[model samples]
Target: MATSTGRVTGTARDRAAGADGARGRGRPKKAGPVRRSMSQHWYAWAMVAPVVVVTAALIGWPLVRGVYLSLTDATEATMGRTIGVNVIPSTYGFTGLDNYVDILTSGLFWDKLIWTVVWTVACVGLHYGLGLGLALLLNRKMRLRSVYRLMLILPWAIPSFVAAFIWRYLYNSDYGVINAMLKAAGLGAVGWLDDPTTAKLAVIAVNVWVGVPFMMVAMLGGLQSIPGELYEAAEVDGATPWQRFRHITVPGLRIVSSTVVLLGTIWTFNMFPLIFLITGGGPGSSTEILVTYAYREAFTGIRNYSGSAAWGVIILLLLVVMALVYRRALRKQGEVW
Candidate 1:
């Protein structure tokens, strides 16, 4: 009996040891943090690699090349030779800030800069006013609301170049619809695109028309998002329409307004086609903005590629400053919220 009990006890101990040994062998080894992290994110990195490569090849390379070109004295005659593989006749050397200096010394730069600012502000302001007003009207219960919305959005749907062409015809001095209307009204004919002040105003008016529809749509969406209870409560408290708009509507639409205004400002600042197609920066460069001037410098006679690149850099710097300010303002608003 004692011998049998010893054998059973020894068998049980052997089984337990074997089980533990199996478990020890089955367990996985722990990896180092860096290797583990790379293993986890390898798929994501692979997915994004193509985009990164394309961006570097396209935008990054062009920007670097443009800066290099700006530092050199590259004109129409020398541009191909400077960048070409084969030897050429003319020699070009690095100007090293000369292009920027020339631009700063010219009075034309300041004038165009000032006009660009004015143009952007005027267009964005008018867009907000007209858009908000129309949004308010549309937000109310009214007849044919869908039809009105569709009609209002038509201007924005049209291509900017087409709209500019249409406006150019409208602003023509002779045989234009605007002049004909003035003649019928017994008022003197006005040179809409001929006079410098009027030309600036004309472009602004056209831009406002093209931009208002987008603002109206954005504001309308924002207005719809506001709870009806807030307005009802305000009215119950004897708040006037203007008071409600000022207090409730404006505050509710603040975020949307800021976003649209920033986008509008950028778009307006870069608006080249409308100004180029309509006035061609004419009337003695009266309506010329920085973008138009840069385009003219790059493409017109002499083709001052380096000068145009310098202008582009200045524009880029200005945009960067604006973006920084906008981001700071957004952070402040977020904190308030």
Candidate 2:
């Protein structure tokens, strides 16, 4: 009986080995050269062709034209003007890097850039700090959470221009509620917009107010995604509140915080309307950011078409560099958005 069992097992093993040898010997046939059929590929391209056309016509053309103009000494008048049915042909000459050189050598650009950097940093810092604090408080199991959320989010819900106008009125040195309160408290009225320093702080505060709600909502969502078990376990292990927050909560929110910080930086950097509506880059251009300054170059006075284009291109390059550096830093820390 033992010899019979061994023979049967040997037969089964032989059969499996034979099957594997057969498969190994029969290699798959090599693929022939692929032939392209117009009919097959045309359909795929047709599906995406409209999007390509629209994008090229809208975005691509404008970008190309802006770059082209930036190299030339173009202005509204030189770009061709039609006066009383007689058309003046475009005769703007290309001047290579002259516009860029002139802009770089100027004192005005450096001053505006410094202020712009300060504005972006101050607003985004306050936005994230205040927003994360609020989000943490709201994440607790507290009553009237919805009510508090609505009240806090109202600033973001309102149109930005409208909010800017309202804040502008409130910051008015005369006939404003803020000043009225100051007077009631026996304090002198402050020129919030009239002074350079106060105007900077005032705009920064308005931007923070408008931006905090977005960061709070994003963080609150992140908080809810973290499992409760981790916090419970930490508490059981004798973890303090601060330890739990620093160890668990912060790591959980890092991805969300990084994303919001990048977005907030970009938005605050190019926030033209808020500054324009509030102080109009006033106090002799003390609060002028790059975007507002570029606007003045384009639309005000003689309408410096090429110079504005140069500034616009420079701003775009700066933003691209900032985004790349930020993403690389986050990637180093094992974070990506």
Candidate 3:
């Protein structure tokens, strides 16, 4: 029996070898290792190199040059050695802190800085209040709701320069929509842009109109994110509508609100188009914000390169401070949801 089993195993092995031999030496062997794509091997770098170089040329080079130029007395007419090129210390003299000192000492500079701060705060405040209010109203059930929202958001969706021009005409003392309405109500035409105070208010008003829709949409999204169960619970606890919003709605919107404040502050502080298009920082410079003033100083005024650089540094520092403040506030608020 053992001999028989051994013979059977040998026979099975021979049959398997015969089957393998019958397959005609198996299929032809596959080729060598797979080749990498051209992009995967080298072309990717070639493609991205241009973008990197362009970014460096546009952003990095200018930034570095500006900082370096800030340290020198290079002027519009003296930049390319038009005023005697030299490598000596006396030739390319360093200003050290004099430029900064001069800018800080100027009363107009401080006033412009203050105006920028006040304008940012006021516009941001009104934007927050009005936007939240409108968002809540629009979020409610109503007839023609979409139409109302569209009409309300039209001012913001329009290009700011275009809106500025439209408002400019609307604020005209003779035939402006505002003056016409006022006259219909027996009030005389108010010189919106001709008077200094009114001109500044007009700028703020236009900014508010242009900014509120974005703020409203942001808040509306936040508002809609609140679960209805919270409102149901508030109702069970006998909470009024105001109380429900105060606790539930406001707390739920902390993050979006913070973002709005941060963005609004930056945008308002840096706002230039409306002021430029509408007032041109006029009514005797009563509406000149820091950015416009910087533009004027750099391109219009005595073409002071160092002064403009100093102002740029100051504006950057102020923005940094504002950012830090926002971050600290965010930390204090923590995550609300």
Candidate 4:
């Protein structure tokens, strides 16, 4: 009888403690759905208010304005004009989807888009491949590894525009370093920037030089993050170098590689400085990618403001679609970020 009474009292005390804990946590759940009033979640809304306002001002406003401009007939010459103290009304009229229709109907869009895709793929591929190789080498103990890393990363440390300008001089047809070196080796001086094919390759080389450092750094971080014990354990199991890498290193670096590859693709797709500065979309516009072509439309000769806006919107949509597709693919592979 005494044992039964003690057990009942202990159960009652446990229930009381749970009630106190729930009260300490602010509120308890109801049997059905519970509605939270503004007073209950005011702190959270307050914390989010700044970010919402900033987004609406910067990204939201520009995107909305660009979309609106793409829908209308805006041009640099006819859109709007202003005096010192007067605000001029915008003359651009809405034309629905005419701009998009024109762009889609034209062959130029598809052509430049194809070139852009090729450029993106080539540059990102070289970047990741060379970067991973160098990262793997540098991760091992070696003499002067730090010096080698510093030298390799120097190109990325320099400003991209400066590097582009330097490469342009190096590619000069007469008395350039590259041509001089070719002559020294008894090889005929080939025009690096004059020919369309060579110009495309030249730009890719410059971009790869500038891009690989970032990829190497990211991959190196991923390499270091994989525990040393994992490799040691693999060695103990008599796993070969290739087998251990396939099983452990690749899986461990997946997150880093995924992020860097995505970022590299996006950056390379929109890379303007190297192409614009080096090629100027020359040799009959043979090397012009989508971004450079849009640039030509916006700033060169008679500015097509609405058309350029349409191009911008198109590029934005394409990137969004690519990102969504990439994310879906990653999700399918069980990689969530």
Index of the highest-TM-score prediction: 2
lDDT of each: 0.91, 0.92, 0.86, 0.91
Per-residue lDDT for 80-125 in model 3, tens only?
4433665333344577877778888989888998889889999999
Per-candidate TM vs. native?
0.84, 0.85, 0.79, 0.84
- How well does model 2 score by local distance difference test? 0.92
User: What are the per-model numbers of colliding residue pairs?
Assistant: 0, 0, 0, 0
Any idea what lDDT model 3 has?
Answer: 0.86
- Model 4 segments beyond 4 Å from truth? 1-55, 83-89
* Stretches > 4 Å off in candidate 3: 1-57, 81-93
In the predicted model 3, the residue pairs found to clash are: none
lDDT (10s digit) by residue, model 4, range 134-174: 89999999999899989988988999899999999999889
Instruction: Candidate 2: count the clashes.
Output: 0
Model 1 root mean square deviation, Cα atoms: 7.6
> Clash pairs of candidate 4?
none
